[model samples]
Each structure stands twice: as C-alpha cells, then as structure tokens.
Target: MLQRPPAEPGMREDEVDTPALILDLDAFEVNLDAMAARLAPTGAKLRAHAKTHKSPVIAGLQRRRGAVGQCVQKVGEAEILAWGGVDDILVSNEVVSPLKLRRLAALNALARVQVCCDAPEAVPLLEEAAAAAGHRLGVLVEIDVGAGRCGVAPGPEAVALAERIAASPHLRFGGLQAYHGGAQHRRRPEERRAAIGGAAEAVRRTLEQLRQRGLDCPIVGGAGTGTFELELETGLWTEIQAGSYVFMDADYGRNEEAPGFRQSLFVLSQVMSAPRGTGRAVLDAGHKALPTDSGLPLVWGRPGLRYVGATDEHGALAVEDAAVPALGEKMRLVPGHCDPTVDRYDWYVGVRGGRVECLWPVAARGAMA
Candidate 1:
C-alpha cells in the first residue's frame, strides 16, 4: 500500500514539500487538452499509455479528457488501473509466462482487457489461460516496425500469427501493434518523419496481407509523443497509444516536432550546498529521484544554470549567473525521461496557484512484472 500526502489547504506551489514529485496542474490540464485536440482532427482514438505516468489518477484524468482508454505494458499495471476504475485497458506488450497470462485472463471478470503477441507460440499459452479462466482474451499481433524489438516480421508471417490467434476459440484478434520506439526522439524533423513513414508502410503492407487472409484488424495501435502526427496521417493505425503528453520531459522536448505541451512534471529538489565562486550548486535529487536514460535533467527556469552531473542522491548544477540559490531553496528539475523518472517517486505533489492542492500517489509505481 502507498501513503498519500495530505492535500495542501490553500496550497501555494512554494509551500509544497521539497523533493516531492511536483505537477503543475495548469500545465498538466493544458497538455491533456492539447493531446485530445490534436487527435480529434485526425480521428485517431487515444489510448494513452499508463506505463509513463503509472498513476490511475492520471489515467482517469486522461479518460475524462477524451482518451478512449489506457494501455499498460504489464499485467500488474493493468490490474491497478482497473481497480482504480479504468474499465478499459490494453496490455500493449506480450505476456509469455503462464503465471502472468493466468493473471491477465482473470482480469476479464472485471474489465475489458487486451494483450499482444509477437509469435504463434504465445497464442496457445494465451488460449490455455483464457480457457482456464473461462474467458475470451483480446490479442493483438505486434509487428516489427523498424524498432527491431519484440515484434514479428510484417506480411505473411504476421498474417499467419494473426490467423492462429483468430482460430483460437478462447482468443480474439484485437489488431496490429506497430510502434517505432526509435522514431520518438529523432531530433531532426525530417528524420522522425521518415522513420514513421517506413513504419507506416510496414503496417500498411501487413494490414493488406491480413485483409487478404480474411483477418481484419480492429484496433491497430502504437504511437508516442514524438511522431504521433505521422502515424495519424498514415491512416494505418486506428488507435494512438501515447503516454508522455500529460507530462512532457526533456527528451520529448528534443524531438523535432514535439507535441505542443509544457513540462508539467518536475523533481522538486532542495539545494543542499552552494559554494560561493565555485560556480556550482548541489541539490538533493539525483538518480534516485529522476531517470537519466535520455540524458541529464534540465534545470527549469534557470537558463544560465546547467545540470552537470548526478550521483545516487545528489545533482551537480553549474551556475554561470552571479546570483546563487541559497541553501534549502527549492528548484524544479525536468527529467530526461518522464516514465522511468515517475517510477522512482511515490507521490505526485499537485501544485496549483503556487501551493500544493493535492497529492496523488504513484499507485502503479514499481509494477514491473
């Protein structure tokens, strides 16, 4: 169980506890709206990925903002979201183990659940689990769209797998999962566009083959904050599974055509040391508080200050300006990757009008099955 911080009464953003996972409510709502608006024009349904935020609180908010449902990477994540009142969820990855598949099958009693499969072998396991639970499972066939990870080849091979899934009495063919993870962070606009174009082509060909084989994909899904527009324009993907729009990160900022949104998520770190004339300041947040896979976290509002390094519990910031942040002064640091960074925290300190309004727990945090 997780302990939630009390709601801040008449909360001012500055009054929130330091080292908390702070969320700018205004920015967050704008992000949710922007994502909805963008997808609205394209007619692409949004099934925002829960693996990024990990909080069912955030998931519910997205659903309220026009997202059709939520997609989680693991069954544990799916279970948490379902319990949190998110009735529709898609496990956008493969479930290989019998134990995990059994758990997924059991979820059908309470929610609309879907899972993905990359090979024919997974179909039988899923079928057995669904039969044991006396439920039918929704299964999507993931095709490799140049990410070169966790997908079967496009065309005949993909068709064969889908046919096998459709043939299963306990399994229903959901659709195709063609996500180009590598295209999400291409810094150059042309590069990102080209990457998704290739992925879309692969998806189109696979869909054509599936059609020939009398397999109609119902919910072709996969996209991220980086290149969702390209996928939308292709008309190949029916559902867009983007999770980072609610809390944009530094890495997403690096994208050439970054989805329009402010970075609502941040690590509220307190300055622990400030050495005069050393042009350096140290904060309490490091690897433990934020993820650095996409690179170092950016110092929010401090243009002259750069986050130079991070240890387990400390982040080094180089200050080029004369004014120094005093000890105990709080600084907001934008993480490089929002998903993994969110996994590190236990609570989201909702800030409104400069004070903490509510504390939303990271309910599905560390749900790595």
Candidate 2:
C-alpha cells in the first residue's frame, strides 16, 4: 500500500499534495501545434473532442489553433462549453432524455449545436424537444464505423435517418458521425489503417446512397489521435474529431511510432513510503488519481521503473534498481487513458520549466448526462 504525501507550508512542485493532476504546458502546446500544422494543408477542420480535456482554457487554445469547433459527449458538456463561450459544439453522442434534449436544444439560442442520432426512436424525441425549445438543431446520423457502439448501420439505414432528420422542421441533417473509437488503440499501424479504411468505405457507401436519394451531407466527421492520419488521407472525413492530441497518454504512446505528436499529460505523484524492498516501491497515486483501464501508468523520466499495480488509493511500482529516490520525491506518471483520467480531477495543475504555472479548472469534468 502507498502512503499519502506530507503537507508543506507553501506550494512548491515537490511540496504540492501527492496524486495531483498535472499538465505539462510546454509539451501540451507542442502537441497542439503539431496537430494544427498537420491539418493545415488537408482542408479537414478539427472538431477537437472536449470529452478529453473538459477544460474551457484548453478548448480556447484549440480554437486558437484553427480547430473549427469542439465535440462533446453530452448535453451537460455542451452547456458548459457554450456557457464558456465556445462558438461551435457537437454533442457527438446521442441525447435521449427529454430533459437532456431540451438542454441541447436550448444551446442553439446561443451557439451552434450539433447532435447525433443512431435510432429512429430518438428522432421524434429530439424533434419534439427542438420544436418545444423553438430552436434549430443540426443532426448527425451516427454510423457504426466498426466501434459496435452507438450508431446505426452504415449504408441505407443511415440514409433513412438522414432523410428523417432533413424532413424535420426544427432539425437539419448535418452529416454522418463515422468514428472507429476502438481502432485508436489497435497497436499496429497497419491494423489501424485497415480498420479506418473499412470505416471510410462504409462512409463512402453511405454518402453515395444519400446522394442517390438527393440528400447532401455537409459534414462527415470521425477520426481519433491514434489513427487520424489514415482518416485524413481517405478524403471521406471532412472533419476529424481528435481530442487526445492535446494530452497524449501512455496507451497512445504505445501506438506505433512516427506519430505526429507526443505525450503531454501526466499525474504528479509523491514517493510517500520508501519501504525497503527489492523490485518494489510505492507511490501516492492510485486508481482514483490515475485511470488504469488501458494499463498502468508509466513512470516518466524513470526508464526502468514500472507502475505495476494499484488499489483505490495506492500505486505500487516495481523498481528495477536499488537507486530509487527516497520519501518526499516527486515523479510524473503518464496516464493510461487521458480522457477518463482527466475526468477524475477538477483542476489541471499546469507546469512549465519545473514550476507551477497555472491551475485550469475542468469546466465540463463530470458533464456525463
């Protein structure tokens, strides 16, 4: 088990409480710039997913970097970002509840709001809500681009959904939401490319069918950090929805090399207990502090150390040598998954040049409705 770090008088980086959520500002901005540069010539605008950072400050930075808009997973997230002054937002997931749909519809009174629909049953509810709110909502038909999650079948079904959305007085059929979320972590570059290729083909067929029906799709949005290049090259995706590029995590680092960006987000943890043991040490960050669904955290700057295990509030590290640091030492931990790990914290402890720079709030952290 790991012990908590001792409190100090002032806010030194080392003296800050253990298991704090840390954002490496320099690295983060570099990642941001790299993504913007890559998308500059492609003509594919970025709809950076706010589900990853959930920070208005980060969203503003992305907006400044040429991102056309931000994509979020829920109405609460849309509300937060819209209130935070984001001009464009897409509720990338489907909104079903009447109350949630009302909230989503209400956003149109302020900013551009797009939402997804994967089922026929959802359309009437959304139409009713939009009509009730007296707002025009942009609707995207979510296609199951191999994620097997929340999307309708890719071809004719998608066309039919689009037709329904287009016919609605209060809603406009925007385009298709064809995202292969599982492909982002497929490890092999070729595998990811192939997965996206199939997804692109599915989108292509869907678009053809829609056009055959005299329907035009203004947007076909999809792609994530790990396999965005493939989607960008496909010419099918008009917009790429990548959020993790701003804060790459351990799992993304495990992706095939030659990636356009680098890891930037980390959890700053303290060595609270330096108990004597070979190949075993403990840290103050655990499951609650750092998500491990993708895998355990990788100890940044420590080549031989491994964050092998964890509990609710403790992380055990497997030290490869006897020269491990003593108690009160601070270390940076690369999170396994940036999105969920970020959702766990309210504040992002921005650090630069080994010093605390600023604290940015996770404005939409728990916007899961």
Q: List the residue pairs that clash in candidate 1.
A: 11-355, 12-354, 12-355, 13-354, 13-355
Off by over 4 Å in 2: 1-12, 277-279
Highest-scoring model, lDDT:
1
User: lDDT tens digits, residues 165-257, model 1?
Assistant: 999999999999899988898899899889998998899899889888888789889988888888988887889999898899998888766
Candidate 2, pairs of clashing residues: none
Q: Where is the poorest 10-residue window by lDDT in model 1?
A: 1-10
Q: What is the lDDT of residue 223 in candidate 1?
A: 89
Total clashes in model 1, counting residue pairs 3 or more apart in sequence or in different chains: 5
For all predicted structures, in order, the TM-scores are 0.97, 0.95
lDDT of 2 by residue, 1-369 (tens): 223333332356675676778877898999999889999999799999999999778889998999999999988888999999898998889988999988888888678999999999898998999899887788999999999998999998999999999999998999999999999999888999889999989999999999999998999999998888999998889999999888888888888763667777888898877787554678989999987898898999887788899899989988785477777788999999999999988778887777777777888877888
Local lDDT at 216 for model 1: 78
